[model samples]
Target chain A: MRNLPSSEAGAGPETVDATRRTLLQTGLFGSLLLGAAGATATLSGCTGRTEATAAGYKFLRDADLPFLRALLPGVLGSLLPAAGMERDRLLDDLLHRIDLSGYRLGLPSQKALAQLFDLLNMRLTRRLMAGIGPWEESTPAQVQAFLERWRGSSFAVLNTGYRALIKLVAGSFYGTPAGWAAANYPGPPPGPYQVFNS
Target chain B: MAIDDIYTKGIADGWKVVDASTLKQDQTYEADVAIIGSGAGGGTAAEILSAAGLKVLILEEGPLQTAANFKDMNDARAYGELYQEGAGRATSDGAVAILQGRSVGGTTTVNWTSSFRTPPQTLQYWADTFALKGGGEADMAPWFAQMEERLGISPWAVPPNANNDALKRGADKLGWAAHVIPRNVRGCWNLGYCGLGCPTNAKQSMLVTTIPSALKNGAQLVHHVSVRKLQFSGGKVSGLSAEALGPDGVKRSGVNITVKARHYVLAGGAINNPALLLRSNAPDPHQRIGKRTCIHPVNLSLAMMPEKVEGYYGAPQSVYSDEYQWKHGATGPAGYKIEVAPMQPLLGSVIFGRYGEELKTGMAQLPNMQSMLALLRDGFDEQSPGGSVEIDDSGAPVLHYDFSDYMWDGFRRAYLSMAELQFAAGAKQVMPLHLDSRPYESWEQTRTAIGGLQYRKQRVPVFTAHLMGGCAMGEDEKLTVVDSDARFRHADNLSIIDGSIFPTSIGANPQLSIYGFACKNATKLAGVLKA
Candidate 1:
């Protein structure tokens, strides 16, 4: 059973590397086949904005990256590195993977995800739907409060939005090889993976 | 040693296999039978009909991924390429998650291998209530035996893995009706990677078994082709049109292909089959096309076991308990069958349904996390009439299923039963997969907590891998879409030969039920066509 929604959101590191990595590594989608993170990818590139024009990834807009940026760190604490280049690269990696997953979503689910993220992308809409966010300004505690409120609300739409965000972020964050060590899945099974992982 | 990929050699040996994505121009083909899927029912029927000297052609929307491609054993690759919508398909409202496969072998390529014959009670109910001719326990016995022997179906010979052992131990301790699940596999490594496609060709999935045999027997298999609609000429399907999908399996390449066959078989499983018919605007005088689509609507309970369950390391499912299934009798309020799920990280995390530190705490316990799901038997009564299937703007399938009070009662009971059994099997804590649920330390605590939990949509993470009905069989055309022989009542040349033909839920994993019934019906269809 899923854990009961706990109201306490005060347990994670607050150090956020607000630097948005410019290199939107396309390896997130490719890494899915290997079932591992692009451990080979590094945070070497300097700041320059690049659009995600890859095919099959059409959901997340550039403006939506900030919303995910603020929420992902709060939702995924130490699963991502606390602070540094490793943290920046992993966050960028997580966002790319999340974007890839968003585009692959079915139409109905895509609409739901788009609607939820759209609310998060706009300050006014975020205030109305999520009840306070200019994501960059909102503290992790505030974001946590917003998620908790929606998750616990009786309205089905809020619950739906919360589940969509949580599933996308958590699933993508943990799916990477960086997160596998924390989860204790000792890589792929030694038997057949030897042929490929080698 | 790497296992041999069967299709490559079979194709080299004069077997016809086409990747529609590679088609540079429009093409047309004719066959004695054009089957619109390559799953359990379609594969089984293909083998039988082709063996009977019928030229069979199988049209599949997904790509043909085999053991060679399955060597990675990656969930993302499997879900992205083999599953319906990157493994994120859900109910139209996004309340319930659906795990349906969309590869060459459809769900057979991705399902946990648990083979059971259609229950005697379910068969009897069909005969009594729906006036379904044949398919009784006695009638289907030989067909079941035939398929079982053909697919190497038998009780798992090895000892149950830790995950299954817990289920067995609990059911035994509780004196419940639990037993070893029979599996369709040969040379199984006990490697627990069946859901990611068997890299060793151990699982007797249709991809490795029936489909190959059918191909060898002169059947044509085409992958990456999504059939658009059946071209109706008054009462019969004169033609079928389809669009070719690209390598990604989602976008079409705009290469339209048409098929003409003496007989058309719709084996696209429950949801796809109904949506295909509905999209074509097929005649449904009684509106029985997409009605009563049964999904053994599942609700799960999680356990923190004393020992490392390693739930993902062996046969995903080898033990199941039917204690609560027949407790209220077949016709009473809905009953459920309990089974364990493989602890894939992403699947577990989603069901773990936590975030940040809360999610991490659960992730840290993955080795000890065990999940038990209840397959609720639906469609037997008015309160639990089951869901329906509709198409989206792009004609893609969308399912709409609402939980009933009867189903909720079944969910409450199933959760309590699972928690009790998990505790009996040495779980430290048991929790129903509900939004409001907390880890209860004891069976008594779980009983108290579960009784108070709401069985609403997102509140409980409901899912279904088993889909049935939607084009149910009956002797009366007014109450059913297909006749007892699974032939469409309105279209003389068309047949619905998959799980869609079942009038109600089978109360078990549906692979063998589909295989046996398709084997029997296709043989009959073969004989009739041969005459």
Candidate 2:
């Protein structure tokens, strides 16, 4: 029920700094398994912007897109089409929906997600936390291993991150009609009622 | 076959409905009564007050979507347009996912239509524990009956949907008490789209019922206007300031609106209601503005049935088991009510909580998936003190909810019961919807696994569609924010006629409880205002 102005959608760099500063102050940065000194030294230089990029997503930046592109295939598995225009279109639609889904969430949820996105978007934190290099250069095996590691991790934060990522991707994918055939859902059943489009 | 869009037709017929998003200039509205939301409580109050000849104004932050918008029957569209935070509202820590509606009808718009009266046990507990007055079974029966008739609530006449039938069959085999659930509907198509908003307008939701009735009674309706704060002086509300939302319905549109009313009603339900009060810095000498909030914390288990369940095609919930809901005394241990959820592919996938090939494989069996949910009755014991509503730096509501060991105990028991029930219903495989859980082939295996399974927050999935009580109601000012009449203890000429006033979680789907309570309280308020 938090009503932020539309301008807040592109939270810009200040939010990222605040999120990082809070994480440092709370010692949660160390909980990410990073040494406090190393995290402060490295993360201070990581001025990653959270604003939506020129690629036209409302919440996800350009840096976030490639990361999602690599992760989606690993998460969707054979549910997604095997490399075709159809697969590209489906992924594009899911990416857009995911953006809206994240964008519409309350400030707290958006902030927490932004923190996760920031961590993944920066290369140093990405390497330290996820053990993967550039998302584009990362192999599917690397992405799968990372997801599995997070999912099976005993740390609550990592588990929470895994739930957030998987639910967002899987929920957005399965919610659309393009993802239904894999699950054998034939849309809403035809009944005695007529659908009047607005 | 064509269901007329009640809102379009009503607006065309000269109903004073305004979409704030379309406004070009700021506006000031004066009314005899101004209601802050248009959900079950607000809808009920609006019709009653307006029909009593008072000029009522209803304001909603959500859009004025109707049956027309619901015709798509698409989960994506529905969640994006109709739900709070796109149905992504969760606890502050994200351990529990919440499903509350944000449309004109509020949750009644998308609720599964399982209408149950305030369970007598809950009413009695509120009276004895909270010193709540005039909410006993006999005192509320007439109000319940009146709303039941008004909303066309009755036990479903059709055969149970396969998803619900499994619950009945399992309970029957186990000698547990099971019964057909009463629903608030008329001419229901059994299309299993209640959660997406009823396309046929046959579910008798407030959007299609009391709202239109209130409009016809000359009530003014405004949508897409977000209330920012309630201004008050000398223990009386002065006026409320609001901002108009753009077509996107998420951000402000730069047009300010002021509402001045003789009486103000807070019917925004649990979370938002407390948030509004907190944002306004409302007078709370007892510091009880956002305490004792109760969500009927739900956990679920998915069963892969041998036959074609097709859980997506029929009524979402038509049968329920109360075998464990009130087995023990209210304060002794956590109890739960068992019901089934429709297995729409999107919802199913999210609940399945798997990835890659396992998720793909599980969803491929969607038609055969029978999911049962256990709603733990919270807020009746010291162990389940319930959560609190706190505002973030942006003044947005953040629910601080954490499960106690007692609740985990309940979750463990509920998982075992659900798995056992599924096996009894002839499920080929059953899996608790937990991150660590895998499907088991028999009750014996499921029992052993569930007993040993980790009961932590991230390990076990938790959810809640029923949000109740933050500005709790009772006679004691020390323990309650509102009185038995639903009037704010600190504010004169202000009343809370929503689920936020519940002294405890009503051990059932609370739409009917809200309707009944609002009808009684609003009627009393109307008499006072008229006099």
TM-score of 2: 0.96
Query: If chain B of candidate 2 is superposed on the true chain B, what is its TM-score?
Result: 0.99
RMSD of each: 9.4, 2.5
Off by over 4 Å in 1: A1-56, A195-198
Of all native A–B interface contacts, model 1 reproduces a fraction of: 0.36
Q: Whose DockQ is greatest here? A: 2
Under CAPRI classification, how is model 1 graded? incorrect
**Where in model 2 is the C-alpha error above 4 Å?**
A1-14, A21-44, A50-52, A191-198
Candidate 2 per-residue lDDT, tens place, B476-530, comes to: 8899999999999888989999999997888898999999999999999999999
Task: Score every model by TM-score.
Answer: 0.91, 0.96
Q: Per-candidate TM-score, first chain only? A: 0.67, 0.81
